[model samples]
Target chain A: MAELRKDYILDQYVIIAQERAKRPSQFSRSPPTPSSDKDCPLCPHNEHMIPGVLEQVGDGRGGWLMRAIPNKFAAVGQEGSAALSTHDPLFVHGLALGEHEVIIDTPHHDMEFEDLSVEHIERLLQFYAHRARVVESKPHVRYTALFKNRGEEAGASISHSHAQIIGLSVFPPAVARLFDRAYDYALRNESCPFCDVIRREKHSKRLIFINKTFVCIAPFASRFPFEAWILPLRHVPAMDKLRKEEFSDFAHMLRKVLRRLGTLGVPPYNLVFYNDERQGMFHFHVQVLPRLAKWAGFEHEVSVPINPVPPESASSFYREG
Target chain B: MAELRKDYILDQYVIIAQERAKRPSQFSRSPPTPSSDKDCPLCPHNEHMIPGVLEQVGDGRGGWLMRAIPNKFAAVGQEGSAALSTHDPLFVHGLALGEHEVIIDTPHHDMEFEDLSVEHIERLLQFYAHRARVVESKPHVRYTALFKNRGEEAGASISHSHAQIIGLSVFPPAVARLFDRAYDYALRNESCPFCDVIRREKHSKRLIFINKTFVCIAPFASRFPFEAWILPLRHVPAMDKLRKEEFSDFAHMLRKVLRRLGTLGVPPYNLVFYNDERQGMFHFHVQVLPRLAKWAGFEHEVSVPINPVPPESASSFYREG
Candidate 1:
C-alpha cells in the first residue's frame, strides 16, 4: 500500500525501488533449466571422475562393502579447526572442518534410493554408524551431521542417491538452540516435544500412515508446503542406536514417505537428520521437505510467515494416498 | 563406491542411498503465474483484500504512499506464549512474537523495487524511522528485522518490489549467536566488528562504491555468489539513526549494487537487513545476496559451507563491473 517513494529529507539520489514493479505472475515461478549441472557423475564408472574416493569396501584387495569419497565440489571438506581464532566476533572464518563423503549405494546406475532393499538400508546405516564413530572422536568434532540431499532445490548437486557426512568441529548455533528447546520440553514435561507430536498425530486420526514401527505425518506447523517427517515410534537417539528389532518398519515407513511425495507431484526435496551429542537423544529422524513453492528473499531477512496451504489441509490430501 | 547392500550387515531393511542413481529433475522451469483474481490479492487495487493493514501514510484516506499490512500466508507468526511458556532453563521458546509488515515500493502495478528515486529512499527511511520508534516500544519485542525478498526464488510472492519489517518478541537463536560473536569480538578487540569490516573493506579494493557516508562491498567470506553489503561509514547501531547527510551514498550504493546484479545475468536475489536489539556495538547493515542457490537439508542440519562460486571470485567478478 506504500508509495514507491517518500518525499523525505534523505532524497538526495535516485531510489531505484521507487519505480520498480512486477505483476503477480512474476513472483510465482522459477526459470526452467535453472543454471546448474545436469551431469550424473556418481555412476559406477563415473565415480572415478568425481572427487577422488577416500575409502572403499569392495575393490577385491579386501572386498570391503563400502567406500567414502570426497564430494567432487565440496562445500566444506575434511579440514579446518574449531578454534575461534579471529578476534572479530561478528565475522569469524576458519576451515569448514568436516568430512564430505559420497556413498555410492550400489554399482547399479539408475535405481532410486527408496527402491533399495531393506538390506541396502542396513548397510547404509552401518556406514553412517562407522563414520559417526570415527568423526565423533576427532578432537574438534562436537557433532557429526549425516544427511542426504536428494534434489537441487534442496541443495543437491549430483543426481546420485548418496548420504553425506559433515563432522562439525563446533556446534551449529541454530541446531543447539533447537536442541535446547526440545530438551527444555523434555525437562519440563518429562517427555520429548517430538515424542509428544508422534503420539498426538497418531491419535488425532488425521494421521497419514503407521507401520508397526515408524510414524509419518505432516507436522502441525509445517514451515514449508508438503513437509513430511519420519520419526521412530519411540525415542532413539542416533541411527546406530536403532534396535535390531526396529529395522523393518523403519525402513518401510521411510520409503513410503518419500514415495508419497513423488505421488503428490512434488519433484525436488531435501532430507535432514539431526544428531544431538549432548542428549545422546541424538534422534535419527528424517525430515523430507518438498519444494512445492519458492523461498523468496523475505524469509532470509524476516523468518517467513507463509500460509497459502496449511499443513493440516495438505496432510489429509497426503493421508488419502 | 559403497554398495547399497552390504554382505555382512545383519538386517537389510534400512533405507540406503544408491549413489550414481537417477535423480529426477521435477521442478517446472516455466515461471508459475497466478491463476485468477483469487490467486493474487496483493495487486494494488486488491491489497486490502488480503489481511491486516496496520497503518498508512497515503493520500490521508487510501491513495497512499505507505501502509503496513500483515501477510496472508505467514510461515512465521506469533505462536504467543502458550507453547513456549515455561521459565525452563534447558530449552527456549518465547513468543515467536515478531512483526511482519510489507512496504509496498510503488503505486504502479509493474514497477520493481529497485526503481525508486533518491527522494523515495529518504522518505522510506523516514517511514521506517517512525515504525521503528513505535514498534520498539511494543511488549516483548526485542529486535526488529527489515529486509526485502526480490525474485520468486528470493521468495517474493507478488512480483511487487517491497521490503518488510519484523519486530520479534524473542530473538531467533541464530541471530543471538551473531550478537554473541559480536560481543566476544568486542571484548577481545575493544571495538565493533562491523566497524572493523568497514575500515578493512574500505581500504581493501573490495569496495564497490562509497559516497561520503555509506560504503558497499562484497564481504570477505560471502556465503552466496554476488553477495553485496551496504554498511554506514559510521558505526551507528540502527538505520533510523542515520542523518539526512548520509542519504546520498546510501541511495547511490544501494542502486549500484542492484544494477550490477542485473548486469551479471543473475538479476534475482534477496536483501537482508539484520538488527540486534540487545547489543551495544553491532551496527545494522544490509546484506544483498544473489539468489544463485538454495539451502538443502544438510545446510539446515549443519551450518552451511556455501561455495561453487567463492566470495573472492564473486568480488573479482563484480568489481570488474
Candidate 2:
C-alpha cells in the first residue's frame, strides 16, 4: 500500500505511501517567518547556502543576475530506481524518479518577476528551456512540468522569486488526458482544439491581449478568477521551438498581464507551462492562474470548480488596466 | 464567456462566471473570527437566520437534535434555468441548476462532530440520507454530493458542526469518471472494483477497523495524509440501502477512526460520500481526507498527488492509538 494508486476510472494517480509523512501537527500552517537579506539563501554572495548552481546569467557587474540549481529538497529525483510494483489489480505502483530544478528569477531578493527587464526575463526563459531539455533527455523522464508559485498562499516558502521545472518519469495524467482528447478531436474533426479556441476567441470579449504571433485570453472555462492563457497563433508543440521574436513576445505579454494583475492587488498566483514534443494534435501554451479562492470539500471531491469571476470581466479588467 | 466550461480533455467542469467575484484584495486569508453562542446563527434559538428546514430529528424534547436546511448562500441553485450553451467547438457552457442543503449535526453550538455520541452520529447520518434522497428526487438533479468540512483549513466558516449536501443538475465529473470506469471494469471482468479492493485489503496491513458488515482502511492511493475509507463488506451501491444495525456500525467505525486522527492532532479534514443508484457497476463508500498538506502548482496543473504518508503507517497509527 506504499505506492502510486491509479483511480479506477480516471487517469489520475496519487502517491499513497507514507515514507516522508509527518505528524499532523507538524503540517499545520504557521505564520510565515519573515526573510531579510542577511538570512535569505537566494541573496547574492550566498552561493554557499545553495548546494550548487547548474547555470547562471551575468549581472554585467561581475555578479550573477539569475541562476538555476537542483532543488535543495526535491519531491522526486533520479537517485531512486524506476521500478513498477503492482499489488493486485486495483493497486498500481512505480518508483518516483525525477529531477527538480529551481530557476531563481533574480539575485536581488526584492525584485519582482513582473518588474524584471525583458532581457533578464528572456534569460530566465532560456535557462528554463535549457534545463527542461536536459532533464527530458534522461532515460526515465517522460515529461517536464515548468511552473511558478508566488506568495505564501501559493506555497512559496522563501521570499525569493523563483520557478520550478520538474522532470517527471511519467506523463502527467492531465497532459495524458488532454493528448487523448486532442487526438480524438483531430481524428474526428481534422483540427486542433486549442487552435480553434484561439480562432473563436480572437475577436471576442474574452481576449486580453493579442500580438502578431501570440494571443492571450481569459479561458471560457477558467477555474480561477482572472485566469488567462498565452498561446501561439501558429502551432508549436514545444517551448524549445519558439523563434527569437516569439520568445521575446511571449515574455512581454506574460509580464504585462502579470503586472496588470499586480496593479489589481492579486495575491499569490501560479503560471504553468503546457507543451509537448508530440506533433499535430497538441499546441504549446502558458496558463496564468490567480489564486483568489480556497477550494473546499465540494471541489476536492468532485473535480468541478465554481469560479466566481467571468472571463469577460477578467479580460475587460486586463484590457482597461 | 460567463458559464460552466467542460475541460476539452478531462471530464472536468468549471464555472466561468462573475456572479460572486471578489476583488483580488478581498480574498486574503485572515485569522478565523471567533464565535459565541449569543451571536451564532446556527444556535438553537436562531431558526429565523436559516431560510427553511427540509428535515429535522427530535431529541425527544420540544427542540430538534438535528436539522437540514437550504443553504443561504448556494453556489448552484434551482433559480437558474436548466440548459446547455455551446459556444463554438472549444467553449461549452451550462446553466448551473441545483440545490444546496446544510445538515446541522446538533442543536448545541459547541459540540464536536467526532465527540458526538454514537446515537447522535447515527441520527446525523440518517438526516444526510434523507436530505440526499429528497434532493436527488428533484426534476433536474442527477446526483447529490454529501460532505462535511471540519476546521478552517477544511473550509468551514462556521464553528458549528454541520455537513452539506449539494444536488446538482449534472453528475460531477469525478463521479461520472468513476462510474464509467466501474462500468467498463464490470463489463470486462464481471466484477466490482471496490468489492475487489475490499477483498484485497481485508486483514491486510491497510486495514484499520473491520466489523461483520463494514471494513475501514487507509486507501492505497490516499490523496491526503491519514486519509481513510469505510466500505461495506457486502456490496451496496446506495447509502439508503443500509439496515439499522449496519448504519449504526458504519457510524461507530467512522467516529472511531476520526477520533483516532484527532488524538494524533490532525486538524481540518473533509469527509465525502460516494454512492450511486446504478446497479452492478458501483459500490458505496465514505472517504475521510485529513488536510495535512496544501496543494500547490504541480497538483493544480497535473491533478496527481504526491502523498507522503503510506497507508500502512496510517492504518497502524489508527489501530494502535
Index of the highest-lDDT prediction: 2
lDDT of 1 by residue, A16-98 (tens): 11112232232233422433223567665555587677766674764444567776654444544445445543344555555
Q: What's model 2's lDDT at B23?
A: 31
**TM-score quality measure for candidate 1:** 0.74
List residue ranges in candidate 1 displaced over 4 A: A1-39, A45-48, A51-68, A77-91, A106-110, A117-119, A130-142, A176-208, A217-221, A276-281, A302-318, B1-100, B131-143, B167-173, B176-190, B275-282
- Pick by TM-score: which candidate is best? 2
DockQ of each: 0.20, 0.19
Give the whole-model CA lDDT for all candidates, comma-separated.
0.60, 0.73
Interface RMSD of each: 15.8, 15.9
lDDT per residue for candidate 2 within B59-119, as digits (tens), equals 7778898888888767675666565543434544455667888888988887779889999
Q: In terms of docking quality, how is candidate 1 classified?
A: incorrect
Q: Residue A59 deviation, candidate 1, in Å?
A: 13
- The best candidate by DockQ is 1
